[model samples]
Target: MKPSKLLITLLALGVFASLAFGQRRNQIEFYGGAAFPLAPETFKDYTKVGLSGNAQYVLFPSPRLGITFNVGYEAFSTDDEKFTDALSTEFTGQTASYWVGQGFGLSPSATVKSNLLRIGAGVRPYLTDPEANTQFFLLGQVNFNLIKNDFSAKEIPYQYDAVNDQLFFLTFNDEEY
Candidate 1:
């Protein structure tokens, strides 16, 4: 058979199979777990621990195959920014600047933090809850990754000479990014 014809035949077969296995109802689930940062530089090593939570709603409009929609959230922060700040501060020529523009002085820098959100779809063979009002169902699911409350970049560094020997700045202890 021609390639296009064969592709159409396969798609029709899939739809037929789904109708043959159709269940009557739908199911939804709510759950939360821990999130691990998979990216190396995006999140701090092991420091990006966070919470994962989502709601999955399944639509078993037919039988064998159902569609799932998942909406989820994951919160995280990385260690690279913290490490970078520390390394920069340790450099010999780098001085801490007291004010925003003051630099090459005893300027304190902070790390960057981030929150992520996730969203996706999935399929399951069987899903049911006899006790629920609905009956005969398949499970559909989705996963979502969302990034909320993104942190701002640290202040840019500038140069200062001995003409401005005095450096006085006030920073709040609770400030974090």
Candidate 2:
């Protein structure tokens, strides 16, 4: 089975178990933390640190077991890089020759930004008694994430060949996807 489906099944089971045999205590909590990329090499030139925040509402049917509903957001740092490439034109119907301009004059650069929204359910089990001043718990959660990416590119100097009526530089101008 898919990982997401398996996670949902476990969360549902936890919720149902808590509802069947647990006392009623409702609580709300807010959390924030830094997220580290598990596979930083996959991202190439991007930063590895991300910021994350979440809010959760818990319903306890028993002193030890609780069902939680959570909503969260995460933002990854932006990364920028420069690339160099050449554009060429081909001539036909007469003497055919390719005109190529290769140099650092066309400095192209790009920036990438990523963000995510998360919604999920989980089970939290308290290790200590409910009356303790400090409470500790083991938590398991299943989250569905919506991801957004913004990619933009630009050329330092736009170049055009009027004789061939061709624009040598092209860019998306800070578009989000």
Candidate 3:
């Protein structure tokens, strides 16, 4: 099935379940999981991995389901820095090493947060705890992510002086990289 159709189906199911379940106050939850980039071919000279986690609160509109408010963190990483260094080092006798840190994302969605895994065509399943006051669960969420690329690490630069056949090395702060 297409992503758009699947998303719409999940939304409809969420609404139905929320209206059927009623409301509860002790509905807080926490979850952690990892994500991977889907379209690596779209980007050349880059490889990405995504990591994620969340804390949630469910507010039931009706017994079986509720609308979930989630605050989450996600990350994406690429090898662009290394690729760039490779291209530059060939022309000059200097070798440069660079490390690219991860990229991050945040997700918020309207979906059903429930304990029971409804069996059938359009139901979404949620992982839950029946025995804890402050519960922990895992729910798969489909969301469009917005990424902010900040944060970097230190870099090292080295040069081979071909004329004198001598080696030189320099260290730099995160800002220079």
RMSD of each: 8.5, 11.4, 15.6
TM for every model, in the order presented, reads 0.50, 0.63, 0.39
Q: Which stretches of candidate 1 lie over 4 Å from their true place?
A: 1-23, 44-47, 62-64, 77-107, 127-149, 153-177
lDDT of each: 0.56, 0.67, 0.44
Count clashing residue pairs per candidate: 30, 3, 5
Better of 1 and 2 by lDDT: 2
Cα displacement (Å) at residue 128, model 3:
12
Ranking of all predicted structures according to lDDT, beginning with the best and ending with the worst: 2, 1, 3
True lDDT of residue 17, candidate 3: 67
lDDT (Cα, tens digit) per residue for candidate 2, span 1-177: 999999999999998878765555688999999966564353434645799999999988788888899999988875453221211111111110121233334445556677789999999999999888999999999999887767666652245566976545556655633
Residues 1-177 of candidate 1 have per-residue lDDT tens digits of: 999999999999989867754545577889999987676543444256778787887776555456777888776655644544443444424433324344334445544556776788877554555345554645455454555443332432333345866433333323353
Top candidate by TM-score: 2
Worst 10 residues of 1 by lDDT: 151-160
> Which residue pairs come into collision in candidate 3?
21-62, 21-63, 21-64, 22-62, 22-63
What TM-score does structure 3 among the candidates reach?
0.39
**Collision pairs in model 2:** 22-61, 22-62, 23-61
RMSD of 1: 8.5
